[model samples]
Target: MRPRSCFVRSSLLLCSTLVFSGTVARAEAPAGPQAPPAPQAEPAVEPPSAPQVEPAPSAPAIAEPAQPAPVPAAPPATPPLGPTRPKIDVYVTAYGELQFAYFNYGLDQNRAGGAQRDSRIEFDTNRFVIEVKGGLPDYGLEAEVEVEFEHGGTGSAMELEYEEFGEFDQELDKGGEILVEEMFLSKKLGANAALAVGRFYVAVGTLSEFSRPTDYLGTNRDEAETSIIPNTWDEMGVRLRYKFPWGLRLTGQLVNGLDSTGFSSQLWSAGGHQRRFEVQRATDMALVVRADVTHFDGFTFGVSAYHGDTTRNRPKADLVKSCEEANPREVAPCGYVSAPLTLLDAHLSVRKGPWSAKALVMYGHLKNAELVSQRNARLSNLLGVIRTPVSDNALAVWGELGYDIASVVGLSDSHHLFPFVRYDYADTQFKPREELYDNPRFRRSVYTVGLSYNLMNVAFAKLDFGHRRLGSSAFRPENTLRFATGFNY
Candidate 1:
């Protein structure tokens, strides 16, 4: 074979081998004309044609219709839909406690009023609470609702005001009671300001965190506060709060005041929570203002004031006859008077490492209690007893200190054991109107020492012994033992 032909064949073979493996083939040149025609014949053919015919009349020109608009390509199909966040975010939490008490069971009690007024043991479901919080970012608002089941049943608490002068009597706990502790809607005013409206805790005292069993250090709340102010007091109204970046905050509220008619010489304003109906009227609104300093870590100092009119807090129609008949010369008519109530309180809280402390002092002034007492004297209820010579001033002071022994000893951080002591002294009759009888029972002091232990921070147990002293050295005091357990989240 010729060399060129041999080269061609080798190249073709190589290409064929690669073709099976996806090689692209190249184009080849056309072959030369196989034969050459005679040139003379071409010339002779060219000379034979001469005649040409005229073209036929051209057909009338026709215009083409306008082309239709081009259709657009559809947008790429949207990615498959995926899960999305909800419009409103919801959170839930709960807290509750159970307790047992051995009242007036001290050695002294066993000797004096043994088994009678000084010795009694009882078990109780202290309080069960449910809380719900919700936030809506699009609307720039938040809401919260807190409900409490106190004492434990629907037939729960039947507190007869006449049960005891200065003690908590479980005899009223036939079943339990339910209360809507707080329900409020707050609008964000700015980065550090907010306005809330609806039923909410009053911002007057330390217990504003609430009088919950879990909020306080001891087994019981400061007697001074619970006696003069509503425990966990909540009222329907509006609150405006502004906070500074440095940890100072100012809060103010406008809410319903306590009812003078419900107020007693013993509990002062505690029984004045008007729960007679679904909605509480705001006819007698009160103003509460509070200022707090929290610039220091783990320390808080606060002051609060409350001023309100109690005359309108009561039902004039119901007590009109009682006041008309009292006919007292030293006091005004029963049903109507300015009877403004003013309260002031200052509190301090310190939590430095393993040491914690709390202290508070409060005073309440009532004008025209002489007139209010005149009305209460004639009024009687299973829950209320008329104390003559109503007090014009009420004062309370309490302090507590605790140290975390587990932490101090370098035990597991999750476990805590704290030994604490607290002293509370409250007297509603600090100053009484002349001619009004001041009972020493109302001027009592409490001393408490306890140990509280927590496991894993979810549950806790508490044991405490308390002593109560009444009426100078003449009247013997009472003593009690308390055990409590609770859980929170």
Candidate 2:
């Protein structure tokens, strides 16, 4: 009886649940006005209630996946800057050479100490140079300070004790002190005109005006021959130059004369005679004029002249008295003395294809007072005053013939080389010889064979073999071999 009652209860509960679900589904369907609807199928069977559609089981909760970060693009690269152009350069140039030299003395002089006057090999430093150049090639300024060697001999080398000043003073004092080589500025004024000022080498002659070392043929100027014109006579001054359309040019300068203190004679300076002859002050001046003509294709010619009063006319009476008393035979007393000098120079060059020829001539003269000494005795010693007379002056002449053999080898201008032969003769009559001015002639002649190469514009290299003979003396064997390289940029 208990089991039956439980079965009946379970049946009743299931029936009720079914009925509830059916009613809910019916309510969810579309509804119409209450009417008796006809079923048209042969055997109408109610379609199974649409299968219940339910939301998908809730997915496991998940955080959104992190997004990857974007990558950055690379930047462009830059190139290095190149060296600046047309810039001013203040640089040091170091170079040197080993030299072998031979000296030939026809007659060994008496009283001279046993100083090696023969063959020798010399190595020298301090031939180095420091230079500063600004501005453009059209117009600019250039300067150089050279090193002087501390040890050398006349036979093999020149010892520049200063070891600072260069082969050329550029700027220096008479006592071998360096002051300034080039303190001047230059500017281009026109298509063919320029101007310059400051301390510079006087433009009084062809040989003295060359600023390049490789262009020179000899070591030193003839002191006697060049005394009147004075090679390397530098002064603080101004220069103006102009080029013409017809291959001609002209240059002029106004410069200070030599100072009183620079004169070789102390007595002249003490007596106030030195300054009395020339304008005296640093501003006391002289004039120089030069004309150059280049025409007929490869031919060039030049003429230059200079005149100035290098002294004041004031001669000390007492000094003259003292000079006469000291060297009565050598020095003669006079009331008035002249204080002026004049110079003339000319040169010509012809360059035709592979051959070039050049010739130069120079003359110099001193005015008024004759040379004398302090001992009332004639200063006729070779080193003393006796060399001069009315016609006792200075003259120099030289010639060079060069051929560009390298041109045949198709060398370019920069690499172009030339083989040259040259001859130089100079006579200094200032050394007094009483009779017809015979004994006192200081004469020298040199023959040179060399090859020169143009390294660049305003730069060159030279190798030369020289045979020097002094006043009819025999040639020295082995002679001298020299090598030089120089540049101005």
Candidate 3:
């Protein structure tokens, strides 16, 4: 073989090996010719003539429409409506009273009149008023009941008017009495009207419920006022009251009065056999109506009228006659004297900020009345007479003014520096002169001034000065200075 032919064969063989064995990879694989053939003869030869086209006219533009606002989500419902506080609650309160009273007399005697060292250092339950009030969920019925501890006592202090002024250490089941202060069931008749029934406080007078430890004035239920309309008196009855949005409340009640007591065997028996045997004559029937108007944040004015018939019979003195009268199946021939007792009361109270003023007037008339000389068995045994005639009418007026100066003057935050004055005037029938025929006597004028400091609602200190003038010209005027400190819980 020739050398050139051998060389060519070898090179060909190497190339075959490289390709077939897949040892050396090709860097750029050859594809079909992408580069246009250098200017094809026809393309280079001539450029095609451009086709003719027309220019379009300018077009009008349109604006896009605005989108509507999205609806907002509502607020989450308020927590299930409920009273701020639960309906059930229990409270306990007590008070201790230390009082020093000074009475001065003997201005005319000239011998000596210094001070009576009668000081009272005692503790009073004041009130163990248990209150149960709540609204039932399913029935929506509202009920309230209050049991009160009324004070009772004996001795010279107890002989005075309004025995409630002393310490009450007696157990309610014993000497102390448990009184039905209030008990009523109420139902809502409308949005602002309510109907109620039960024994409840009479709807009359301004000061009936205004007595508080914070009050500086001394004297409760003035004779003329309370004796007539009987403040804080209660009777079994029905009532309706409405509250206005403008802060006015009107209430009306229909109840059994004094006569009801005589009819109730429960009350008669409750007092025991002695009382039942003692009280011979009793009341018959009575009716009462009252109206009150109150202005929001301003004043309250009220008027009340009551009429009733009271029995005027003295108990039979002779034991044999009484036993025969009370004989079984035999109705007692108890003598009954009919007498009409009518009362009218009016009151007005104004509260402007810390200053308050109140006035009240009560008038009572007893037509053709007789005073039983033998009012009780003891009295009859002591006096021998059994019946007496008493006829009279009475009028009583009282006024009070008070101001709270805590804001104007710097005092303890919990304290109220109050200066107060009260006045009372009344007419009486009892006369001191035994020889002269009993005439209408006027016993009037009660002046009081006091200041009270409070250490929160649980404690208070009071200093008061009072002057009272009686009808008797010979009797010296009475003056009283009182200082009291009280603690309560």
Candidate 4:
């Protein structure tokens, strides 16, 4: 054999042996796990003079394997039993009023000597009030507190006592008052009902429900309600309220009744509010029921009724009926006489667009009013009561309407300018019994006109003129001009 041929044959034989050995080694290796295949090397091309061999194709590139995705960790365990703390929120608000007034008649009807002679001008701090409200949302609990300071909250007052036939008494302890208008805690009974306990406003009239100065159109509160009852009346009591889905609300309350010792002819039950002492008497209880309907937008109407015994709440148990035979040891030979008081009222309010209006009518009756008058007439001079006879019935009606002139004059919505008129009639001696005299001084009618300006519902100013007429034209008519300013938040 030629030397070149022998060399070529030997090279081909060596390559074949190498390939067979690699295959056998791979096949005999352990078969437990497999790794990614590695790229194989290309075979080397022979020299052109030795052999005509085509170049082996290059091996394709191998890619690295993708990394595995991460596994999520497990969450921490929670306790089976735990108390949840409720979220509590608190809010505070305040309002105040200052007043300047000019009147053309005497303030005291008894001392006027049957003629309106005294004219007066006065400046006063009408009221300053602060309120705090708090709520626990999760527990459905709410709390509110309101404090009021009137007429600077400090002074000495002079009172005229008719029990001693026009006597003067100095009330050094009671002039201006620091009043707790409301303080109550409420708990939700369900989605539509709630219960409240503590001192709260009696739901009897418009003033008790809407007490802010800006709530009404006139410079002052309604004269009829203020004259016949304690305006913004409040007593320690429990109240239950429920609201229906169709815009009806119902309320019921049980509260301490009025003191008969304070009842009088001029103001009827106005002075009956138990403010003469630090602690109030609660021997007599009152029941109040109220219902309101708001089915129409911007309108609400309601009726309320109050019934309670008055004789038992007097300062002393002295109004009992005479016994046939009296015992010295027994305080009341016969059981005390019944002198219950009853009141009923209907009220309506509207605030639609640029117009606002309010109307109310009230009637009240006192049982055995002649006997009450006789007892009051003989009271101690220091008690400060009018000795005149009290009638069995009282009636009051008032209405006010206003229109926003700002809307008509192309003013911004944030500014409100309302021109309003109000009418009031209150007859403390609406009807008299045969033994009682119907005093014309107790019947009064008032007409008022005013302009009110408000800035964004936070600040307000008002100017008003009022004329008052007595039941009989023989008495001179009275007139007043008032200016008031206030803020609410």
Model 2 is weakest, by summed lDDT over 10 consecutive residues, at 266-275
Using TM-score, rank the candidates from best to worst.
Answer: 4, 1, 3, 2
At residue 72, candidate 2 shows an lDDT of 86
Better candidate number, 1 or 2, judged by TM-score: 1
TM-score for each candidate, following the candidate numbering: 0.76, 0.55, 0.58, 0.80
Ranking 1 against 4 by TM-score, winner: 4
In candidate 2, stretches whose alpha carbon ends up further than 4 angstroms from where it belongs are: 1-117, 125-179, 187-192, 216-229, 259-284, 295-298, 313-336, 349-352, 369-392, 407-413, 430-436, 457-461, 472-479, 485-489
In angstroms, the error of model 4 at 308 is 0.3
List candidate 4 stretches off by more than 4 Å: 1-85, 111-115, 155-174, 324-330
lDDT of 3 by residue, 201-237 (tens): 7665654445444433443334345433444566667
lDDT of 1 at 244: 98
lDDT of 2 by residue, 359-433 (tens): 778776545334322221322132122222333355677777777777588877666577888887666554433
Judged by lDDT, which candidate is best? 4
Clashing pairs in 1: 153-175, 153-176, 156-175, 156-176, 160-382, 160-383, 161-382, 161-383, 161-384, 389-436
lDDT, model 2, position 352: 82
Among residues 3 or more apart in sequence or in different chains, the pairs in candidate 3 whose N, CA or C atoms overlap within 3 Å are 370-390
- Over the stretch 1-489, how does candidate 1's per-residue lDDT look in tens digits? 454454454445444434533434442322233213323223422332311211222212212234566889999988768855559988998888999999864444223323235477989999989999999877678999999987887532323233465332324435677888899999998789999999999997788964655456687777767878888889989999999998999999999987777777677877778764334656678999999998999889999999998877564323343444676663335644568889999998887888878888999998888778777776544434344445789888898898889966778889878899999888978878767777776787899999888776568888999988875665676788999999887
Q: Give each model's whole-structure lDDT.
A: 0.75, 0.49, 0.51, 0.83
